[model samples]
Target: MTDPLLTETREDEKTAAWWRQAAVYQIYPRSFADANGDGLGDIPGIVSRVDYLAQLGIDAVWLSPFYPSALADGGYDVADYRDVDPRLGTLEDFDAMVAALHERGIRVVVDIVPNHTSDLHEWFQEALAAGRGSDARERYIFRDGEGPDGAEPPTDWGAAFGGPAWERVEDGQWYLHSFATEQPDLNWDHPEVRADFLKTLRFWSDRGVDGFRIDVAHMLTKDLTEPLPSRAELELLDRSSGRHPLADRDEVHEIYAEWRKVFNEYDPPRTAVAEAWVETPERRAKYASAEGLGQAFNFDLLVADFDADQFLRIIADNLEQARATGSSTTWVLSNHDVTRHATRYGLAPLAGRPVKQGVEWVAAGGPEDELDRARGARRANAATLLLLGLPGSTYLYQGEELGLHEVAAISAEQRQDPSFFRGASFDGLGRDGCRVPLPWTASGSSFGFGADGAHLPQPAWFAEHAVDVEAADPSSTLSLYRDALRLRHLLQAEEALVWTDTGRADVLRFARPNGWEIVTNFGEEPFDLAADAANVVLSSLALDGQLLPGEATAWIAPA
Candidate 1:
């Protein structure tokens, strides 16, 4: 395909607003690459890999949290938002990394965690020391107990990581923490708390960062005066429905609107992508409104199964919602939090049913256990093509290009996620499976991830999917990503997506305005594409003559 979209030299349109229709790569700093041989990936290590990212044809990089943290929630418990973690690198190193990325025409989007702060943070520490009813305590959500002697908690709210959301201080006051106890929720009702975050936003933006990925974007405001919902009601508050006391409230949008004002003050205007897990598409659209953050993650497709009907419905819903709000839709597959799609697609139950709820772990032995690694990989590749071919922006998680599978066998002693430790039933099975360090080379210590062993142990089978190993083979997953991403930039820039009825119920066929067609076969049987397809641009797997195999995707021009 020729560069049809680049024919117009609209220099005035070309500015820092490059996020629209961009392919952004998410980098989990601890697991990306280790330059200093310290077994942990750092900013300098990421700096070393800039050329690799440029070669992959990504427009931007969204880095996960790397602030000064206790690592209680894997850097989500941020102690200091202004500086880089000593383990990761210094602030100087962060500046160098950003400069290198910008030089390569890649934008940098850092993770901004405004919902909570580490208990070890100076403000949180002062709140604890200043005792109850003090000004310091006002920075966080601190409330007195309801019962006699203040023995009972304020309410029956539950934490996302597993226990009671309220933890009592030595002064007999309970503070709310929606996640881990080490991370106390910030009191957005306080003007000082809001000002501090505004300063934090400016601090990074002043350092030349292009944008931010707001963590827990829907979780800043809470009606602390209202009685907490019952445990049953809380359980009803999944990703899709039900209104909670603390999440997706109308007040949260006000905060983002203020942030948006600050974002616009910059040249070309810094953009923010919200990590809001709101219920309905309408509610999600509110977070991405003109006054709000401008982009919110549309996770409907991520929660869907590999079925054609479910995929089409989610895509249509997302695009419609984005259009309603005048914002671009954001598509994502795997991230640091969820189970990798490579493993999720292999589980037998997901083959027939839609994955509405988040997946934690798949049982090892069951009568209907149908965990096929090869099949899962094939589906993952197909799904990537489908995601990229869509009409808006896409986010790619680290190590996905190598087609890495979930390392579900990590032992109990090596496990680090707070979710695993908090829930009895979730023991030995947490997010550590997907957070394993990347394998750069096929051999050497930690698969060349570092000089020493990785922070999270790499599985023995990781060698098979190492970057050096895959780069040499043309048919490897890494090559597929390179080819797909390069072609995606050329073909998807100015195209409009129109769904096509392939007549087969199990097939999803969509056509683009640029004479490109995409067909994905989710059915058990092979799909004959000889009649509909002219020249094959790409295929997730080797096609049997002119037949697209089951669990595969093909890109072609119309016959």
Candidate 2:
């Protein structure tokens, strides 16, 4: 039997190291909740919902970009970094929201978009008026156009959103955007840019922000050499140690190291994570180092298939990364930027490969018409247990706990993602389906999201997953999440995890050193628990007598 004193010590240690193994919930501001009936979620709404989050058993809340923005890229294009957007709330409202969350013992992580600023930002506006080569222009990445008359873009790089990364100016020069035309990439080499971001970091930290998630962390510090490499050459650069002309430049760490110093100024030293999309483990480790942001997202599981081999491979690689960085790795399945895993799991693999589920499928009545949602939700529910049972942090996008799926379809005219309208390149891509407003009740113009309507439409089927509807049902996904989380606190006490061989195809079984046995059946048949599996602590789905259903997970008490 475990001693009370030992258990207490473990609890104390867990408190001090919460960020390492936190269950962070991501809130996409516009869709989470709404107050003032403005058709958009506001800070007051979040303040009102703090109790809900606290009850959900999350360690922290990751609020997506809510700073002053033009909504060009769903609030990622920041016009102001230090204050809340007027549409979302006033700074005073933000303070109350933070206060409410902290009162519930929940930490707050705000998004920090340092790579670029909205074109409407004061500095960017001044750059346009200051003319080329001026100090204001130097604050951004402006280059002389290529060719004789200076009419062509400076580089052949494509913007992540769609078209050319460089946009020509009225002054016969070109400025690098790397995103929407309304957003201009800032020059990290500029002292002013570096100094201003430090100020922004402290500004939020002073306002009780517990952490920052650096947006596009790998794309800062461009190699401003003449004759920029083509996109093909940029791909080749990833294989070499040489700095690419565009992204993942080595000098970017200098910026993070400086930010780390600022992060250390707080009482507990505010924490941070990088949204770096780097591929190699060694490269990702640099961003996740303690001297830098302390953590970088391990996104392998985000796009991995449901197959056991793929999941095990991703988990192994991420755990290895955690060992190398001396920080717990992060796991995530769905977010505002990607298709909800609920919908993704519904579709069959395309020719034995991971299927790409996009706006096209979501628009065509979703998988409801051509796929089995039961299989999808069953697998997703099991994955949740698999994730929480692991040894690191698990981030959950809002609404997944209720087993919410993507909206059936979004009309083209109502679609608002920048990718939707940017170009045909993104024609099949747009994140609106995943960003649709959440359903809080079974009935309402916006399903209790607000008094009137939601910014993004929620489908009628959303009523089936509404909080009020599911909260009353014992077998509902909401109850499963609530129970699983309550048990996770007890089960996660033992950090070390060992993979157990089940000697079966498409099955995964792992055990915490001192906790329950986690068994997941991805195979086609039900799995019978061994005789030692005497007590069942939690099941992701209903068990068929002594057999764990296919596409299900069971946590049997330690034998």
Candidate 3:
């Protein structure tokens, strides 16, 4: 029989070790749904939405840092890794939420912030009070200043967001903070620091968390030498050859190797994906290697243009590198950190590449008039379909299914990201645009986010893409995602990709091992698909009688 269209059922076959070849939906808890009237999304809000997640056919849900925090760096500044933030929920609430997801046959992957801790964390507080050269201060990367009276930072190092990476203490010492000053980098060389993270892993694993998304997986260990490497040396270090003094050092893999031991001790073997930002695919695969975390995020598609050559090369390299490490590739397009792809694809081209426009582009009141929003939407839809049809795991960020765009209209006074205030060269426009509260329904000031209000403001136009509105339209992006994900569930066992030449530079065509073929048209001209309508499986845009529309993607079954 021809491959039957799959249904969104709780199939035991699609789990795929509960990680590999899985569809994991990322829920930015603060903006996903709000249960209480406190104007913020919480665990209870997520608990209430388990049914929706199961309906979405995702194998797991990766909840971004929900631990106790000061809201610095959007919960990445974790004060307590062992417990849930009171604003979000309590320990019991967390357990209940985990249980709910498990009951629905959905796994939970928590965000683990091992690279740093909140300045308000107990360890950091102790480091502050313990004075310079004290045992408590050793818990973090602290050093004496370089210049007169210690006015200068330890070295010429700069922060990930902006400014000096080191923060001066009341004492003469300075502590390193790769990101915001509120987040102090931990001393991974410290035994207790290493042991504490092991305890953290066990704490969540014991609570039934199936996996973890390691924050800054490659930045955990640093060279931390006296008279640290100069900014030029650090910046000029060849990423292809030697270890980096600040990020992606060789010693970091030792930390992850230890982590793999703990992950292996679990029943089904808890899985983890490294959020490493290394450039080379081989280096990126190291984070996902057998000795390290089992998977690493492949972000090649995120920054690339909607061109076929770029997509094909990235897909081929990603699969090859990931396979070499005996790990599955983790693919993503947009997340809480960047601008939504629908909006990103709408921007004007720069230097023959997709302009590196992020939330900042939107924040600056970008060229909305010149943006081909329709074209962007088409490309994004096609891209997502292509991503879903690939051989490995796919991560779906919240609001993408509803075809959400980056909301630049947000007022500056209401913006909350640290990058906005820090003026960091990295994602300088701030990530608040992409992190806006999701609209579940078209009604209410908060658009069904909660009873009272949302922490971040939702624009009025958000109503057009509300879940309730899209749920009624079969042609909507929401319906397209629902159908695509369900159909993908049946292809969990297929893992090989064989490229098929379409005789066009603008067309990307590939065939899965299971006789299912996928084709994407990125050119201005539409391409005629050889498959008949009876053999068509799914498509981003409805086929015009066997002709795949421009800026669209389609799946066809074997004749």
Cα lDDT tens digits, model 2, 231-277, are: 78776775335276666778889889999999988877888999988
Give the Å shift of residue 162 in candidate 3. 1.0
* Root-mean-square deviation per candidate: 4.0, 3.5, 3.9
lDDT of 3 by residue, 1-559 (tens): 1222221212553334657788899999999988987898999999988998888888889999999999989999999999889989899999999999999889999999998999999999998988988899888998888777887777877887878888898887888999999999999899999999999999999999999999888888877676678887787887755377777777788888999999989878889998988868768877888788878998877778788888878887777776577677878989988878888788765334333344435632345566677877888999999999988889999999999988876666888888878877433568888899999999997999999889998888899999999999999999989999989966554576778778899998877767788889989788988545568789999888878889999988777
The Cα local distance difference test for each model comes to 0.83, 0.82, 0.84
lDDT of 1 by residue, 1-559 (tens): 1111121213454475477688999999999999898888999999999999998989999999999999999999999999999999999999999999999999999999999999999999999999978999999999888888988888787788888989999989999999999999999999999999999999999999999999999889877665666767766765443245678888788888899999999998998999998778878888888698988998876666778889877877777776677677888988887767887677664445332212333422111245678887888999999888877789999999999988766676887899878872232366887899999998988998888989988888899999999999999999999999988865664525777767798998877777688889998799999765458879997888889999899988645
Candidate 1 segments exceeding 4 Å error: 1-16, 226-244, 351-369, 424-428, 531-533, 557-559
* Candidate 2 displacement at residue 8 in angstroms: 18
Query: What is residue 142's positional error in candidate 2, in angstroms?
Result: 0.6
Worst lDDT window (10 residues) for model 2? Answer: 1-10
TM-scores of the candidates in the order shown: 0.93, 0.94, 0.94
Query: Any runs in candidate 2 off by more than 4 Å, and if so which?
Result: 1-14, 239-242, 350-360, 363-368, 424-427
